[model samples]
Target: MNLLKTLAAISSMTMLSRITGLLRDSLFARAFGASDYTDAFNIAFRLPNLLRRLFGEGAFSQAFVPILAEYKSQKGDAATRTLIDHVANTLVWATLATSVVGIIGAPIVLYVIASGLEGPAFDAGVVMTRLMFPYILCMSFVVLAGAVLNTWREFKIPAFTPVLWNLSSIFFSLFMVKYFDVPIYSMAVAVMVGGVLQVGIQIPALKRIGMLPRLSINPFAGLSDPGVRRILKKMGPAVFAVSAAQISLLINTNIASRLGAGSVSVLQYADRLMEFPTGMLGVALGTVLLPSLSKANADGDPAEYSALLDWGLRLTFLLALPAAVGLATLAEPLIATLFNYGAFNARAVTAATAPLMAYAAGLLGIILVKILAPAFYARQDIRTPVKIAVGVLIATQLMNLVFVPVLGVAGLALSIGLGACINASFLFTGLRRRAIYVPHAGWLAFFLKVVVAVALMGAVAWFSQAQLDWAALRAHPLLRAGALFLIIGASAAVYFAVLLALGFRPRHFMRRAK
Candidate 1:
């Protein structure tokens, strides 16, 4: 397979998902604004998403994909299908039980996550949490199907599935708000509906690949399967690693809840902006690299494994640095153009800009973690990341103590960005010390070229943004959006144009996966 082309395809699909997601947030901000109710909804939505990452995407995918790839590479088709059946059956039961418990304990969970929420906001959170809790079960199935498809090199379906969810939210948010006593309750319904759609779309793709799992009648039936046991064993450390990160998020949400009514919503808006480059680059690359890395390890080809990691890291730097520079330099314009409408006013835009810029400061590090952690994961070594994550968690809270008071909500974002840098640093050092990855030649020159290009790009972005007051252009929403797009387009063109002049080429990034 042409890995660069595959990466581009996946990134393109991911870009669509991010675009729809931004539209969804834009509609949400216009309709709801940063208020007590929006805070309630954001916190409520995060509850199921947190668990979904833990049980479905985060820990589960990291642990499951490597093993699945090994099975596919070594055990042949029938045996691989059997492994899929057992793993799928076990996961279905586990997530079902978790969802039930979460639904019943919604109030308790909300309290633990955001104790400061009270009265209407607290009530809304409990209701929404309960309504959306089953989303965990739906996404678990979706992610299992997605991981299977990704291992088979069928990246488009999984990359595109998120768009369905975003579309669903947009539809519901636009049409269904009036049906509920609490308008935001419609979003919870959207979450549930979107989850179902996400799961539904993956089924035919799985069947076509002949990897559709035949779930057992008895949920407990798969516990004795050796593959399932192995997955469970690996999941021990994987769960801890994912939980450490989620714990930090939970802590941040709790802090934001206490800080003020709209603090959580403001931070969430900033995070949405940050996730654009992350989902497009970090997620797209990690999804592609893990299976290839695992296959290399399964075949005992260390050179191939190292080359894949080098390719991913280099690609990350080439793309992510320019994106970071754009985000930092164009924060106000981007935030204002996308979300500065209705309830999300000038103050909200201003409030979100600082955090977005702070997040931009560590964009490279955040994306690097996505690339580096998978190197360890593909080798079935989750404990190292778990240890590093624990220390980063502690370090993040320490920084929060120093930053939050001084910078308010932006401080929380800064701490998380710095923590990601620390986490990425440790992962990179671990890879080097263990001699698992050696830097390919031309890295220093490559670094210099990207830095120079990013400098030029940043200057263009800053100059363009300064030419107008994005906030005052709210009356001219279309014009505001057009100008922002033009600035971003021009900045990106200059960055790539500089790289081309300096000696970078698409062919240099093209690698074939064995």
Candidate 2:
């Protein structure tokens, strides 16, 4: 399997998902603007998503994929299918219980997440939280199916399924807002519908691979399966590792809520922009790398394992650095062009731009964490990342204390970015110290070439953006969007042109995986 080709395929699907997600956010911004209600909706939506990451994509995938890959490789078809059935059965019951508890405790959950909300905003949050709480149950099943598909190298289905959720949200945001007494409630409805659509799409793909899970009649039937027990044990530290990061986000949201109304929404807007590259590159690469890395580890091939990590890191610098530079240099134009309409005014654009730039400052670090953490995860060493994550959480909050007072909401973003850098550094060090990853030759040269190209790209972006009054062009959104795309295109051309001139090639980065 050509890993670069696979990365490109998955990234393209992710690109579609991110594009639709941005459109959804833009519509919501236009319809509702940055306000207390929008804050309520963003917070409510984030709660279930945070759990989905913790138990679905984040911890569960970390614990599940490596083991599932091991089963397919060594345990034969019958045993692997049995593991799948029991695991799915166990996860369904667990997430269903979690959803019920969350729905019943919606008020307390909202208060814990963002106590600063009051009046209608607080009430709306509770209602929306309850409405969307069951989203976790849907997504848990979706991600479990996705992990199986990825292990089978059926990447496209899992990668494309997110677009279903995005489309559902886009529909409701565009058409159904008017039906609600409180317009933002449409978004909550969208979340529930989207979850169903996302999970539903996975079934046909799973059946095609002959790995569709059969839920046991008794939910407890999976408890005695040795493979299920192994996964459950791994999940303990996996949950902690993922939870530490989620806890930091939870704290940041609470802090933002206290900062003022719309603060949570502002950070969320900037985060959506950040997610574009992070998802396209970080997520796409991580998704492909983990299963391959697990195979390498299962075969006890340290050399192949190290080579895979090297390819991911080198690719990270080549692409992520330019993206980070583009985001930082073009922050205002990007924000103003995409979001400077409806209730998202000039002030809102400016508010979001600062955090976007702050986020850009640590984009490389953030993407690197996505790459580095998986090395540990593939080796089934969740405890190391959990320890690092906990320490990073403490450090992030400490930085928040110093920066939030001076920088406000941007401080929260800045702290998160810097903490990601810290986390990635520690993971890299751990990899080296354990001799789990020995850097291949040419890294120093690779670093210099990417830096030079990124520097040239950043200059082009900065100069092009400065020539336009992005906010003033809000009246001509098409022209603004056209110019923004043109500038980005030109900047990308320059970055790649420089790389070509300096000896970088697609073939240089390509690698085969078993």
Candidate 2 residue-wise lDDT, 1-514, digit = tens = 9999999999999999999988988888999889999999989988889989998899899999999999999989999999999999999999999999999999999999898999989999999999999999999999999999999999999999989888998999888988999888998999899999988899999999898889867879999999989899999888877676577778999999998878999999999999999999999999999999999999999999999999999999989999999999999998898788888899998889999999998899889988998899999999999999889989999999999999999999999999989989999999999999999999898899889999999999999999999989989999999999999999999999999999988889889997
Candidate 2 regions exceeding 4 Å error are none
Can you give the lDDT of residue 309 in candidate 1? 94
Candidate 1, residue 19: CA error in Å? 0.3
- For each candidate in turn, the TM-score is 0.99, 0.99
For residues 1-514, could you state the per-residue lDDT of candidate 1 as single tens digits?
A: 9999999999999999999999999999999999989999999989889989887888999999999998898889999999999999999988899989998999999999999899988998999999999999999999999999999999999999999989999998899988888899998899899999999999999999999989988989889988889889988888777665567777999999988889999999999999999999999999999999999999999999999999999999999999998999999999999999998999999999999998998888889988999999999999999999999999989999999999999999999888999999999999999999999999999999999999999999999899999999999999999999899999999999999999999889999998
What is residue 178's positional error in candidate 2, in angstroms? 1.6
